[model samples]
Each structure stands twice: as C-alpha cells, then as structure tokens.
Target: MKTLAIVGAGPGLGLSLAKTFGQHDFRVALIARNQEKLDTYMQQLREMHVEAAGFSADVLHTAQLEAALARVKETFGPVDVLEYSPTPSITDVASVLDVAPENAQFQFDYIVRGALAGVRAVLPDMLAKGDGGLIFTMGGASITPTPMMGNVGIAMAGLRNYVSNLHEVLKPKGIYAGTMSVMGWFKNTDETPARIAASIYEMYEQREQGEHVFEV
Candidate 1:
C-alpha cells in the first residue's frame, strides 16, 4: 500500500490530513514528538480501519527526525506524500518595531527549518521514484504582514519565500511542493479539517506550484 507521512500529527489539521488520505486507501505513518498522544491518534485511525502507525521524533533535530522517517519506510513503505505542519508558539508583536533581531532565529527554526528537515528526509526517495508530494501548512501572517503579528509575520514571510522558490526548483524534478496558507483562525470543527484535507489532496493532484491561500 502507498504511504502518507504526516510530520506533525496532532488533533486538528494533522489528524484531518491523516484521515483524508487514509480514506483514499493510503497507509499512514504519523510522526510527532509525543508518543502517548500519537498512540491515541494511531488507535483512532485503526478504529476507522485505516492502516496506520505513529513514530515519535522532533523536527528540530535532524537525526531523530530522519530515524523516524526511516522506520516509517521500513514499516509502510516509502512515503508517497509528506505533510509538514508543526505548530509553533506565537510571540505577539504590537508593532513592526517590536520584532527583535535576536528572536528572528527562533521563528525561522520553528517554520522554515522544521519544514525543510521533513522535506530533506523524504525528497531523495521521491526524486528516485520520479514522483511525490510535499505540502506545508503555513498561515496568513506569511501572506499579508500585520502589526499584531509583526514578529510571526516577518518570520513566516521568510518561510513563504523559501517554500515558493523550493517549489520551482523541485517541480521539474517531478516533486510537487506547495503550501496551504490559512488566513483565519482554525476552529476545531469537523467540517473545516475535512475540507482543508480534501483541498490539500486536490492541490497535490493538480501539482500546484505555490501557496494555496485560504482566506476568511
């Protein structure tokens, strides 16, 4: 069976992505840092009759993340699709001036670095196969910077640029790279997650070249 590896399998969009792909008969390999939480989620997938497993790993550390990916491959087969959607704590920014230089690196680490690690983990196999999907769940701050989210805005702006450029570079190599930019608050409603997941699958099927914006 084919595999869909979600690097940040949490209760919201991550789990939604799991089920969305799983419904289409994709075996799921969920990756996250919390074993207990992931185990719960894995059980839920089984209850739904989806072939699934969970692996614990932190994206900040390359070794741990790569190891988890290796195990996923060993268990379910090479990951046909990779979703990177790690949520980071946002530091409020009242103004553009409020964003400190020292804090910039931390923001970059949260979004850019984490997403790249997941891509790097699976890209080689995708390239070898001559096909794969890599999707990032970014947000509105990356699209239109506002005073309230100045800090996160600037940081996500960097991530937005990186994902866009990477998409261009990877597309020719038969890898579809894209980001789903959410512009509004994500409520924990069943419809929203399912809708977003279905949209993501559509984007992948279309091999979208850049960010797919979801505005309020």
Candidate 2:
C-alpha cells in the first residue's frame, strides 16, 4: 500500500488529511510537536481502522525532524506522499519594525527554515524512488502580501518559490512537487476538512509533470 507522511498534524487540515487518506487505505505516519495531540489523533485513526503511527518533533529542530523521518521510513517504507503544513503563529506575523529582532528571527527560522529543512530531508528519497509527491500547504498571503502579516507572508512567498523550483528540478525524475494555496477562509464554510482532503487527494492522484500551483 502507498504510505503518507504528514508533518504538522493538527486539529484541522492535518487530522482531516490523515482520516481521508486512511479511509482510502493509505498507511499514515503523522508528525507534530505535541505528543499528546499525536496520541489523540492516532486513537481517532484507530477508530477508523487506519494503520497509523505518530512522531513528535518541532520542525525547527533539524535533528529531531531527521530522527522522526527515519522512524517513519522504517515503519511505512519510502513515503509516497509528503504533506508540509506547519501552523504559523502571531510571532510569525510581525512587521519588521514592530517586533524585536530575535522575534523576527524566530518567525523566519520556523516559517522558512523549518520548511526547507523538511524538503531537504525528504527529497533525496523521493528522487531515488523516481515517484513521490510533495504537497505544501500555502496561504493567500503568498500571492497578495500583507504588511501586517509581513514576516509570514514573506516566508510563504519563499516557500512558493521553493515549490516551483523543486517542481522544475524533480519533474523529470517523476517526483511531483507543488503548493496548495488556501485562498479563502477555512472556518465555517462548505470548504470543510473533507473538501480540502479530497482536493489534496485529487492533486496527488492526478499529478502531472511540471504542475506546481494548486489554488483552492
């Protein structure tokens, strides 16, 4: 069976994605910083009879992330699908002049550095397999920059570029990489967890060479 490794597993998109893929018979490996939440999510997956495992690691910590990914590979084989979806915080939303230098640094470290770290860690295996999917959860701010959300927007823009570049570099190798931009509010809409999960699955299922942008 195909395996999926989802980083930044949370209450919304992460958990929903897990359930969606699990229902479709994909073995799932979930990663998050909170052990408790991971355990809770695993239990929920079990209720659906999904083969699931959890790993705890802050994406900002490269060593921890590496260890976690190693464990995932050992358990589920080379990951067929990878989802990167770290939730950005208010610290990640600061303007250059409004926040302390250290705070801005932290935001940059997590928003940009953490994501690149994940891509670096996973891309080699995907390239070797010559068939894999890297899906990044992107925000509208990437397309329309907001000064109030300065740092986060800038970091997301960088991620978008990274995804596009990766697509160019890896498509020839049969590794499909792309970013899914959530252009609308996810809360209180018909665009619920199920809808988003279906969209992601559809993208993964119908991925084409050089397809790098999925705006939803």
TM-score of each: 0.92, 0.90
lDDT of 1 by residue, 1-216 (tens): 679999878988888888988898899998999999999999999999998999999877878888999999899888899998887755434356776875666667767788777888888899999899888887788887677776667778887788888899989898888888888886756578778888898898899557798764
Model 1, CA-based lDDT:
0.83
| lDDT: worst 10-residue window of model 2 | 207-216
Clashes per candidate, residues 3 or more apart or on different chains: 0, 0
Residue-wise C-alpha lDDT for candidate 2, range 1-216, written one tens digit per residue: 988999988878898899899988899999999999899989999999999999999988988887898899898887888898888765457774565666666666776787777777777888887889898886777777566766677678887888888888888888888887777566523457667778888887777643333445
